[model samples]
Target: MLTPRWILLNRRKLGPITAVAGIVVLVIFLGSAFFSGPSQSQLDKQKSFTTALDNTFASRSFRFEVESKLLGENGFYSKVEGERVMPDKVHIKGTVLKTPVEFTQVNENTYMKDPFSGKWLTLKDIKLSQSELFITELNPLANFNFKDIPEIEMVGEEDLDEDKCYVYELKPNVVNAFLEEQFSDFYYKVWVDQKDVNIRQAIIKANRPESGNSGLDMKIRIWDYDRDLQIDAPVKASTTTQENVPY
Candidate 1:
């Protein structure tokens, strides 16, 4: 019923339309490849950031601010600021129950400043490793290894302290051993500087039986990297040893 001429005409008519449809399909395939989900490269980026963070803190000093909000019947909160130097040295100052308190550790010696006496009390024979002072596994910036984490996901890009950062969501692989029982669950979103891979901020949500509300929320900010700190013993006149203080 159909002639050869008619067949040729139909094929010619379908050529452009078929080509357009093929192009549309190709575009979709490429789009999905580019934007579907976390690719291998994305995972590598997050790992790279974590590695860089570990390396950076190993040889550098930084300042940190910790803010905590207690949820429960008591509604308690606190903000603590501290600076740490590598090898050994940390200075932390905070207020508890409207009372100001501070402590400084240098090498094997630690000194606690009494709020009421206005004097520094020496706490002897204390050695704090970098891991303990920096909160290695508990903090986003200090944990160099993530072998425990089942997976980490890129949350997206955002701004922190006016700087652009790539945000990543992570959960700690916590194991119940000794004090670990107190730490129930941990969720963290870390913001790393897009330019230098430096950590700008970390939001940590934790569950602990120690809290009246059993919820612990903390935000840690790191800055002032590589800055020299002047940490010297308090004036002798203003300082007293625990044994020297009158009971």
Candidate 2:
């Protein structure tokens, strides 16, 4: 029993309401597209940063002096001093002090040299590829290739000591089968300096099933960096192990 006039009136009211709703939706979509994700310029910048890191790693070779403190289960502590030469060579000479055991890395090999016994005990190979190091070092920088990475998002900005930095959170990228198995359920959070595009901090949590160390967490902090020398050296590095014994 509705009149044509009533129908027209209802249509007019609905039209305006629908138009406003559509405008609101469009605004929201545009806002999310613009503000919620990285801009095109940012993506390009990331690609450039990644390429720079790749070139840096490929072209440069340098010496590194590293000092690290390893914390074991049940609150035991061991300090180590290491010197590494790039192009697949490292030498670490240090003592646990408490256990009086010496650890050393010659070439790509890692060993525990016993002072008491005067014998060298060879350990597992500390293997790292040039490409792997390139990717690992570069991925922290802003505007780096991130489409291939999953669950990786810009966390925020941070002030690391005196340096201002950008923080990013990285989770396992399942599409990469090698990475999926290698970094299962792991979170790699990196902090990169704004000015130099150098990584300031890297925290990694990994699962090692074959070694019986299922849950492993470690942090590497590059307290100082030299772009002139093209080295991202860690002034301080620390590792936490579930086992009470030093490996």
Candidate 3:
């Protein structure tokens, strides 16, 4: 066997060049993998949705309203307006089942307004009918409870209360003790403020309950975060008869 000097020399010169070419190809593959799939805009959208969800939960002082409708003959519809202050203070006034209802909670004391008489009463161990409806209504943050944020998208932009807001539609695994029994297929939406990253509004809709009643639809609006909106006792317990309210 005879070794060719020209062929050996060319092999040595091409070896390094082949190595460099392979390195270049590897770099290109890594870059594509890193940059492609789930575009940058999608990542940014998910980040904003998560931030707004966190901000809404951390809020101490905020005014909110929740409007809910159940689609059936026996289904209840309510539009509740409420405000929450840190430590333990909440005032809610709204109509449930076409009856006017109002309640305010401060520390251990709870006050309720009679739907018929329109008089405030101190609640000790009693609750009005369909009181479970007020759970998410009283605290707007309750609706944002998600076990996992699996899908998020920037649907569009909208103006809420004169503030420009970015609207996000998200599919999140929900965990709610209140509606767990009868609801499924939960869909959520949030309207986040552009400047402050505040969740100005949110909507939660679920597939019709198994009871054959129409599904539930809830819309929530939030504002005045951390602002001293002024919550005070509307009436003294002594002034109103004590009602055995158990909540």
Candidate 4:
């Protein structure tokens, strides 16, 4: 009788123990299933966004319109309007009237067509390079493979004027070393439209300690984007230079 009682008690304990163990296993399995991987839709969305940007940059010919304001060293502000047609090649013409002149990138070169002489003037290639223009004009979206730019973090959603947009911030990663050195301590803030993932605005800032200048800030606002034509022709772009030198 005593042996039978002991056996019955052990069986009773085993029943609850097995039940708790099973519950624990189920919880672990569910957690892993839910959180272990991204859903198919999430993966597809990322792929779609990347592909759209890629297509936008790969277009052969497009029209570009831009308005820019420059801050001069002598405490003067100048405004300019520019248009470019990249048909078989790139051609840009802008005039500040009396202040300064600006040009656009063509292939790996920078040239300005003189309004007076009706001749194209070749300028020394400086900041704007072919790769830089490609990334800047069409795809401000972070490319994980080409440039080790950090995975863009969608900070929040907001309405840029009337278009709904997602604001993303990009930081320097391993692939950004070249840019980091050239630009020197820079940050890019991009506004991408929610509807199409099209970039509507980009603000690029850099700290120039070498030149004893405070820094340089460039703001590019794209009012309209042509998706079918694969163009992001900025309606307005402003660049401000605030140097530390005596004003």
Candidate 5:
């Protein structure tokens, strides 16, 4: 009788012990499932969301900062700050080969102020060199189109500044002819805000033709969307005609 009673008591304890062990196993499984990284399907959804945002972003005003570096014997690094308003107005201030250059565009006309001369010249009034013209065309935000990309994929999610963004790696079917002439095998990575669909940051990398496999990289950051920016032409007293400077 004593042996039977002991066995029954042990059986009663085993039930609760097994139940607790089962619950512990279930909690661990649930945690692992919840903490797993995003899947391919999730990445695809993010890519689609970003594509839609890029298509419509230029309709508003924004500010941008660009950091450029050329890797090779003739390597150089420069920083550019730009502001733009919708329709057609832009201002860019930056350095090229350590020389400061500032330019503004309102409608079809562009004005450039020389760093050394401290004088401003209008694009319409002057014969611009290829390099100067190229600088004027550097509108990274408006110049790009989602349709131009051949391949794009979500790399991961990252925090840009204080905003959470989805990072994407992109390869274009063709780059701008002028850019292609200077650099080969170019690629881009962009960070898009998860909440607002705004582009938070972008990076462009390419190999210089003259430097063999040496590369050039440019990091672009966009912010201050729809903020008020006061852009105006240079004062008439400081303006210089094109003929004053030799091209």
Candidate 6:
């Protein structure tokens, strides 16, 4: 539903993510796992579980909704919704620190609309690529990289938007630099498609004693897997792609 004009009018100046990127040394934010036994059934279960995660992460195209909160807070702190088209294109919009943020990316270029001047600016120099730092920053799923995975078990099954899904619970440890110093206890509840092995929904909760009593948590819902889509750059005349960068 977010069109070119809608994004330009709605997005605010970058805040927390921008701060993280500005520091340079501490960016690349974002995070899973399991145990063993003496039985063949256990091994099969583990293999199936790992396979679901692998296939889901391999989802090159999908629409996603990521709602995250700082632990010990009263309500969700960040509510972002977006779509990603494979290779190198993304569109995301939501609020951070209670301020709206929106952007579109195609390859090395990141486009944003200045809240003050209401003008589009293209950051062609930024490398928010899959192989580098900003992958986790833009794609919340990239944060699922786990340094250690705790015991995982099939928790239940459910219907998400009419899609039959298998649900699993995992208490994982991750290295999300964005949350490293401030958050702890990465607990996840994931829903995967019954037939496609693709992830459908996930919720991540972490503790942050400083925020309040609720701590921090994030919920992600993914859909429209691999659907054909077109994500294009803004107009040449209206966007500032070649001028000196102005934030």
Please provide TM-scores, in order, for all candidate models, with all chains considered together. 0.71, 0.50, 0.77, 0.48, 0.70, 0.71
Query: Which residues of candidate 6, in runs, are more than 4 Å off?
Result: 1-46, 73-76, 128-137, 209-214, 237-247
What tens-digit string does per-residue lDDT give for candidate 3 at 1-247? 2469878889999999999999999999989988787677767866887788778778879988889887766677889898888756888888877888788876666677777676777754332222564677666676777888777788888988889999988777777777777677778888999888889988888875555557888899889898886767566443433434444
The stretch of ten residues in a row with the least summed lDDT in candidate 6 is 27-36
lDDT of each: 0.66, 0.48, 0.76, 0.49, 0.71, 0.70
> Over the stretch 14-48, how does candidate 4's per-residue lDDT look in tens digits?
99999999999999999998887766755555454
RMSD of each predicted structure:
5.5, 10.0, 7.0, 9.7, 7.0, 26.0
Q: Where in model 1 is the C-alpha error above 4 Å?
A: 4-37, 74-76, 127-147, 174-179, 209-213, 237-247
Clashes of each: 0, 2, 7, 0, 0, 14
User: Clashes in model 2: which pairs?
Assistant: 46-143, 46-144
Model 3: residues with Cα > 4 Å off, grouped in runs: 1-35, 125-133, 209-213, 238-243
Ranking of all candidate structures by their lDDT, best first:
3, 5, 6, 1, 4, 2
User: What residue runs in model 4 are displaced by over 4 Å at the alpha carbon?
Assistant: 1-49, 60-88, 91-146, 173-181, 209-213, 223-247
Put down candidate 2 lDDT per residue, 1-247, tens digits, no spaces.
Answer: 5799899999989998999999999999999998877887667545544543454344323322222232233333333333333444433343333555434343444444556766655544443222242222212222223335556566678898877777777764334334445445666676766776755566766554454444445555543332233322222222223232242
Off by over 4 Å in 5: 1-40, 43-46, 49-57, 125-132, 135-137, 142-147, 209-211, 237-247
Residue-level lDDT of model 1, residues 173-237, one tens digit each, is 65434225545567778888787777768887767666645676778888777788666645552
For residues 188-232, write the lDDT of model 6, one tens digit per residue: 888878778777888888887455475766788888888887777
Best by lDDT: 3
Give the per-residue Cα lDDT of candidate 2 at 137: 22
User: What global local distance difference test value does model 4 have?
Assistant: 0.49
Candidate 2 lDDT score relative to the true structure:
0.48
Error of 3 at 98 (Å): 0.9
Candidate 6, 135: how far from true, in Å? Answer: 6.4
Q: 1-247, model 5: which lDDT tens digit per residue?
A: 8999999999999999999999999999888877895667876756665564654464478888878887887787788888877756778888877889787776655688878778877765432322333442346553244346667778888998889888888776443555666777668888887777877788888887676757878888888888888777667525555555545
